[model samples]
Target chain A: DQQVKQNSPSLSVQEGRISILNCDYTNSMFDYFLWYKKYPAEGPTFLISISSIKDKNEDGRFTVFLNKSAKHLSLHIVPSQPGDSAVYFCAAPLDTGANSKLTFGKGITLSVRP
Target chain B: DAMVIQNPRYQVTQFGKPVTLSCSQTLNHNVMYWYQQKSSQAPKLLFHYYDKDFNNEADTPDNFQSRRPNTSFCFLDIRSPGLGDAAMYLCATSGTGDYGYTFGSGTRLTVV
Candidate 1:
C-alpha cells in the first residue's frame, strides 16, 4: 500500500476557479508534509510545507490544510490560472534522522482550462 | 538560481549495455539523492549520499549502484541495462540540516 495516496490522477477546472487536490496518508508518524509542482522537462519545485502541529499554511494563492486525525491533507489553489497547469506531488518525510529522504505519492495532474 | 544539472538528458542503450547518468549541483548541499520515475508513477528514491556515506534503498536492484566522488557530483550506474530499467532518472540535492531538496531535469533512459 502507498504510504501517501493521491486518489485523483487528473483534475480539470476553468480559469479563476478553485482547484482542490487531496491526499491521504497511512502513516501516523509523519511529522512534516510538502507539496511540489512539476512541469514537463523540468524538475519538481518545492511549493509549500506544513508541520503536524498546525492545520493550515497559506502562501499567496496556495494554501495547504492538514487534518491529522483523518490522516489527510489538501492543496488549494485559488483562482487557478493556466500557468498553474502541471503535476502536483505530495510528500512525507520518513524519520530517517537528519538526512531523511521523502516518500512521494503518484502525482496528480491539474489542467486549468483557459 | 542554484541549478542542478544532468548531462546527456536523453540516452539510448542496448539491453545488455551499461549506462551512467550524472548530476552536479551548485547548491553545495551535503546530501544528494538519486531517484527513478517510471511512467504514471511518483519518483522513487534509489539511494543517497550524506557526504561520503552511501545509503541505498532495500528494494533497489543489485545492478543499480551510485557513487558520490565529491560533494558536487554524483553518478548513477547501471551495470547491465534491462528493458524494465528504461525510465526517467532524477538527481536531487538538499541541505543536510534543512532537508528541503532541489531537483534536476531528469535523464530519460531508453533501452532498446
Candidate 2:
C-alpha cells in the first residue's frame, strides 16, 4: 500500500503566478517530510522540507505548509517561473532507525504557461 | 562540487543478460540508497548501505543485488534482465535517514 499519495497527476499555471501542489500521508509517526523537483532525463533535486514539529517552512520563493493533525502538506511557489516547471515528489521517513525507509508519493507534473 | 554520479547514464541489455550499474558520491555521507523509478511513478527503494552494513528492502527482487566495496562507491547488479526491468535507477546519499537525500542523475536501463 502507498503510505504517501499525490492525487493530482498534473497541474498547469500561468507564469509569474502562484502555484500550489498538495500531498497527503497516512502514517502519523513520520516526523519529517521533503519535496524534490525533477526534470526530464535528470535526477530529482532537493527542493524544500519541513519538520513535523513546525507548520511551515520557507525558502526564497518556495514554501511548505504542514498540517500534522490532518496528515497533509502543501507546497507553494510564488511568482512561478517557467524554469520551475517539473515533476514534484513528496517523501517521508519515520526515523533514523530500522524503519528508516523513505516512502514517496507519485509525482505531480507542473507546467508554467506564458 | 559535492554530488552523486552514475556511470553510463544509459545502458542497453538483452533479455537474460547480466548488467551492472555503478554509482559514486563525493559528498562523503554515511548512508547511500538505491531506487527504481518506472515511467511517471514514484521511486521505490531497492536497498541501502549504512556505512559498511547493507540493508535490502523486503520486496526487492532476488535477481537484483548490490555491493558497496567502499564508502565512495556502490554497484547494482542485475542477474537476468527482463523487459519489465527497464526503468531509471537512482543513487542517493544522505547524512541521516531523516533528512533530504541528494540524488544522482540516474541511469536508464533498457532491457531488449
Candidate 3:
C-alpha cells in the first residue's frame, strides 16, 4: 500500500496564476510533512514544511496547508513563475520518533507556462 | 558550501556485471542513505547508515550492498546488475534527524 499518495501525475498552470498540488496520506501517525522540488536531472531541494499542529505554513509565494482530519495536504504557489516548473514531492518520516527514513509520494510534475 | 556529491553522473553496465556508485558529503552529517528511483516512481530507500550502524530495508535485494568507509564517504555496490536494476541512484545525508536532509544529484544507471 502506498502510504503517501500524489494522485495527480502532473499539473499545468500559466505564469502569474496560482498552482495547487495535492497529496494524501494513509498514515495518520505522521506529524510533519515536507515538500521538495526537483529540476530535471537534479536532486530534490527542500521547499517548505508544515507541522501537523498547524493548519498552514507560508513562505513567500509558496504556501502549504495541512488538513489532518482529511489526511490531505496541498502546496499552493501563488503567482507561479515559469521557473517554478519542476517535479514536486510530498514526504513524511516513516518513524515519527526517528524522523530519518521518509515515505515519499510519487512526484507531481508541475509545468508553469510563460 | 556544504553539499552531497555523487560521482559519474551517468553509468552504464552490462547485465550480470558488478557496478559501484560513490557518494561523498561535506556536511559531516551522522546519517547517510541510499535510494533507488525508477522513472516516474517515488524514490525507494535501500539502506542507511547512522554512524557505524547499518540498517537495510526488508525489501532491498541481496544484490545491493553498501559500504561506509568513514564519515565522509558511502558507496553502493550492485553485485550483479539486472535489466530491472536500471534507475537513478540517489544518496542523501542528514544530521541526527531529518531536518537538514540533503540529497546528491543522483547517478543514472543503465543496465544493458
Candidate 4:
C-alpha cells in the first residue's frame, strides 16, 4: 500500500512566480515530513522539512506547511527559478521509531519556465 | 567534502549474472541505507545498516543481499539479476537524531 501519495504527477509554473507542490499521507504515526529535490541523474537534495508539532516551516524561498488533521503537507517556492525545475519528492517515516526508514511519494516533476 | 559516494555510475550485466554495487561514505554517519528506484518512481528502501547491524526490508527479494563490513563502506550483491531488477540504486547515510539523509548520485543498473 502507498502510505504517502502525490496526486499531482507534474506541475508547471513561470519563473519569478510561485510554485506549490502537494503531498498527502494516510499513516498517522508519521511525525516528520521532508521534501527533496532531484535533478536528472543526480541524487535527491534535501529541501525543507516540518515536524508534526509545527504547522509551517520556512527556509529561504522554500516553505513547508503541514496539517496533521488532514495528514497533508505542501512545499511552496516563492519566485520560482529555472533552477527549481526538478522532481520533488515528499517523504516520511512509517513510524516515530529509531530506524527512521522513510517512505516516499511517487514524486512530482516541477517545470519552471524561464 | 564529506559525502556519500556510489561507484560505477552505470553498469550493464547479463541476465542471471551476479553483480555488486559499492557505496562508501566519508560522513562517518552511524547509518547507511540502500534504495532502489525504477523509472519515474520514488526510491524504495532495500536494506540498511546501523553501525554493524543490518536490517532488511520484508519484501526485499532473496536475490538481493547487502554487506557492511565497517562504518565507511557498504555493498549490494545481486546473486542473479533479472530484467526487472534494472533500476537506479542509491546509497544514503544519516546520523542518529533528526537529521536529513545524504544520498549518493546513484548507480544505474541495466540488465540485458
Candidate number achieving the greatest DockQ relative to the actual structure: 1
For model 2, state the Cα shift of residue B95 in Å: 2.0
lDDT of 3 by residue, B47-76 (tens): 999998999999999999999999999999
Instruction: Kindly report which residue pairs in candidate 3 clash with one another.
Output: none
Per-model chain B TM-scores are 0.96, 0.96, 0.97, 0.97
The true-versus-predicted C-alpha distance at residue A75 of model 2, in Å, is 0.2
Per-residue lDDT of model 2, residues B20-103, tens digit only:
999999988888899999987989999999998999999999999999999999999999999999999999988744477889
**Could you give candidate 4's per-residue lDDT for residues A56-102 as a string of tens digits?**
99999999999899999999999899999999999997768555888
* TM-scores vs. true structure, each candidate: 0.97, 0.96, 0.98, 0.97
lDDT of 3: 0.94
What does candidate 1's lDDT look like per residue over A61-111, in tens digits?
Answer: 999999999999999999899999999999998884455799999999999
Quick one: best lDDT, which candidate? Answer: 3
Q: Best by TM-score, which number?
A: 3
Q: Lowest-scoring 10 consecutive residues by lDDT in candidate 3 chain B?
A: B94-103
Query: What is candidate 1's lDDT per residue for B39-102, written digit by digit as tens?
Result: 8898999999989999999999999999888889999999999999999999999885774688
Q: Give the TM-score of candidate 4.
A: 0.97
The docking category that best describes candidate 1 is medium
DockQ comparison, 1 vs 3, better candidate? 1
Runs in model 2 deviating more than 4 A are A96-99, B96-98
Candidate 4 chain A: minimum summed lDDT over ten consecutive residues — where?
A93-102
Collision count for each candidate, in order:
0, 0, 0, 0
Q: Model 4, range B1-112, lDDT digits (tens) per residue? A: 9999999899999999999999999988999999999987878999999899999999999999999988999999999999999999999998877456889999999999
